[model samples]
Target: MGATPEEGAAESAAALDEVAESLVSLWSLAHNAPDVPVPATQLRVLFILEHGPVNVSNLAAEMGALVSSASRLCDRLEAAGLLLRDHGRDRREVTVRLSTDGQALLDRLKVRRRDDLARVLDTMSSPARAALIWGLAQFRDAAKADKGPGSAGESFSLPA
Candidate 1:
C-alpha cells in the first residue's frame, strides 16, 4: 500500500529540514564573498531595512533581539555609512533606513546569490525546477499562515 498523505507530508518536512541547512550553507558562501562580506547578523539587519525603514524597537522585535543590541548594530552600520537614521513622527522615535551604499551593497549581494542559484538550477531537470517553484510557494504561504501566536515560527529567530 502507498504511504498515507500525512506520512508523505512528514517525509517532506524532514527533507525540507535538510534543504534548509544546505540553503544556509549556500547563503553563507554566496553572501561572504570578497566584496559583500557583511556578517550574517548585520546582513539580516540590512535585509530587514531593504524591506523598508524600521524603528529600533520594531527592528528588535523582528529580530527577536534586545533593543540595545539592535541599536548597536545600527550604530555600526551608521558609522560605515551603510544606513541612515532619521527622526520619526516624534523626536523620540528614531527610524532606520538603508543608505544608498547599503542598497548598492545589497544589490550586489543579491546578484551574486541569484547567479549562484542559477548555476545550480541550470543543472536541475526542468520539471524538478517547476516542482520546486510550486512547492516553495506553497511552503511560503503555509509559513506565513503559521506566523502568529506561538506558532512554529515563534521559535524562528536570527542567529546571534
Candidate 2:
C-alpha cells in the first residue's frame, strides 16, 4: 500500500504552491521588463480593463477593494497614460478603459513572458514539455469545474 489519497493530495498541493510562487516571480519579471515598469497592482488593473471598460464601483468589487482605493489606482494608471477614465452616462459613474499604451505594454509583456517560458521549456526534455502542457490543460479544466468559493464563472483555455 502506498500513501493515502489525503497524503497524495497534500503532496500535490505543496508542489502546486511552489509552482505558483515561481509563476508569480516570472510574472513580476515580465511586468518589470518594460521601459516603464507598472507595479503589479496597476498591471492587474490593466488586465482587468482588458476585458472591457468597467465602472469604478464594479472594478472595486472585482478587486475586493474599497471604491476609493480603486479610484486612486485608476488615477495613477491614468497619470501614467496606461488607462483612460471617463464618466458613464451619469456624472456620478466613472468608467476605466485601457489606453493604446497600456495594451502595447501588455502585448510586450506577453511576448517576453512566453519567450522566457519557451526558453525554459526548450531546456526540458520533449516528454517533460508534453507533460507540462497536458497538466496545465487539466488544471484549467479542474479550475473551471470547481464551483466552490471564489468561483466567479471565469473560464480559461490554453493556446493551441
Judging by lDDT against the true structure, name the best candidate. 1
lDDT of each: 0.84, 0.82
Clashing pairs in 2: none
- How much is the lDDT of residue 91 in candidate 1? 87
TM-score for all models, in order of appearance: 0.87, 0.86
The parts of candidate 2 lying over 4 Å away from their true place are 149-160
Candidate 2 overall Cα lDDT vs. reference? Answer: 0.82
Q: How many backbone clashes does candidate 1 have?
A: 0
Model 1: how far is 119 from its true place, Å? Answer: 0.1
Clashes of 2: 0
Q: How would you encode candidate 1's per-residue C-alpha lDDT over 40-142 as one tens digit per residue?
A: 8998899889989999999999888999999999999999889999997768889999999999988888777778778888999999999988987777667
How far does residue 13 in candidate 2 sit from its true spot (Å)? Answer: 0.8
Ten-residue region with minimum lDDT total, candidate 2: 151-160
Kindly provide the TM-score of model 1 when superposed on the true structure, using C-alpha atoms.
0.87
